[model samples]
Target: MWRFLSPQILFGADSTEYLERFEKRRAVIVTDEVIKNLDYVSDVSKHLENSETVTIRAREPCIDDALELAEEMREIEPEVIIALGGGSVIDVAKAGRILMEAEIEPEEITPFTSLEEYGFRGKTSLIAIPTTSGTGSEATWAIVLKNIKERRKVIMAHERAMPEIAIVDPAFVYSMPDHLVISGGFDALSHAVEAFLSSFSNPFSDSLALNSLRLILDNFIMSYGGDRDAREKMHISATMAGIAFSNSQVGVVHALAHAAGALLGIPHGLAVGAFLNPVLEFYAERGVERLGEMNRNLGLNILREIERIEAELRLFEYIPVSEIESHRSEIAERAMEDSCIVTGPFVPEREDLETVIERVVRRCMREES
Candidate 1:
């Protein structure tokens, strides 16, 4: 048996206006300082009759940060939570909302764990409004938090962790920075690619994955060039990729990205960008038939397309490749323990991961030279 899951999505122009439907209901806007400074919070708050805004300090929240937000939520006990920022803010709200309603440890949240068993009854509704066109945190059940003490990312998920709604309005992302545009595009691209290659991929996920991949591949460069039409396509594609991967899975690219982000303080999207091509190349060399199948089905060399995108956007220049090289073995070891590692089309050995990391380093070196 298989299951496909997704939040009810409100997409396109003025989708944020959907929040006004909950007029007079008590609402909390969970966001970050950066987003709060922007008009996004006020824009969202203006729709509700009664609402409070909470800003998370960390760009990437830690366990304690999520727990603290949960404690605050418990105090306010708002009827609805509006996650109004990028993936980090949305993830915190996802984790915080469940932590508020249920009495359980953060690690207890998993695909197999029954949230209902822990007294979670969805007393508080979650609505995610993504400011950026990446991470697809608004649509997925997954939550990623940092374990500061251990220097690893805590990947958590429960069916209930998914938001009740995802508002994908292009208005918010129209003014997004060029760097974010590049990073987020790559992140969405990786999601679609990894979902298609996942061991758990099914027909439902495959359709979304392929569609998202095509859209992202076609529009990423144009999106980065500040084309509103391309940006809108990217925003929609990111959510589709999120739902695709949520129902299926991400593979070695994500596993390695997660490890590097946690240990090296790299942004998740940037890390995903850095590792994507190298890992895909690794899969191709190992004769992962799915890569060839995807290429044939799309009638395009996906790797060649990725290489073009990377070069066009100077994707590798942002990463600290030498630092990553120094910690390559450690990153590989940590990645092997990630939950995403096993869900890849084929499980890789430590040596395979090392080889991929070496590829990333060498590629970056060549780019620099």
Candidate 2:
């Protein structure tokens, strides 16, 4: 048996106004200092008149951040928690809501664990409003928190972690930086690709993945050039990719990206963007059937398209290839431990992961040369 999950998604322009429908219930808006300074928190708060705000540091959230936010939630006892920012802010809210109700460590929240059994009854509803068109954390049940002490990323997931609502308004992303466009767009692209190649992929996920992939490819370049219409499509496509991956799962690209991000302090989207094509090439080298199938269905070689896009965007210029090469062994070891590895088309051994990382380094070096 299989299951599909998604939040009640409100999309398009002016969707943030939907928050005004909530009546007397107390609300807490969770965001970062950067987003708060952007006055987006004020915009959201205007709709949620009876609300409080909690601003976190403007960086990737760590486990301690989640725990601290959970403690604050417990004190506020809000009926609704609005996550307003990028993936990091949304992730903190998702994990924090559960931690507020359940006395468990963030790492203890796994896919197999029954949140209901641990007394979680959704006392607080989560609403994710992303300011960037990436990560798609607004639509998924996954939460990635930095394990500071261990120097790795801790992937936490559970059905209860899925947000109750997702507001995907393009107005929030109108002024997004060029670098964010590149990183976030590639992150969405990787999600669609990895979901299609995942071992757990099913018909439902297949359709969404393909549609999302097409939309991304069609719109990403235009969106990066500051086209509003294209940005809108990219925003919606990201949510579709999120739902696709959440149901079908992701593969080696994500596993390697997670490991590299944790070790190198690169942003999640940039790390995934850098590793995506390299990992896909690794799959192709192994004669992975899904890659060929995707190529045939898309009516173009997906790998070649990726290479073109990477070149057009100058993506390889951003990644520190030498630093990644130096930490190849550590990154590969951590990748083997990532939950995403099991869902990949083929479960790779530790040495196989190292080989993939080495290839990525070589490719980046070639690009530079």
Best by lDDT: 1
lDDT (CA) per prediction: 0.92, 0.90
Which segments of candidate 1 are over 4 A away from where they belong? none
Among the numbered candidates, top TM-score falls to: 1
TM-score of each: 0.98, 0.98
Writing each residue's lDDT as its tens digit, candidate 1 over 188-212 gives 9999999999999999999999999
lDDT of 2: 0.90
Tens digit per residue, CA lDDT, model 2, 132-182 = 987889999999999998888989998899999999999988889999999
> Residue 324 in candidate 2 has what lDDT?
95
Error of 2 at 356 (Å): 1.4
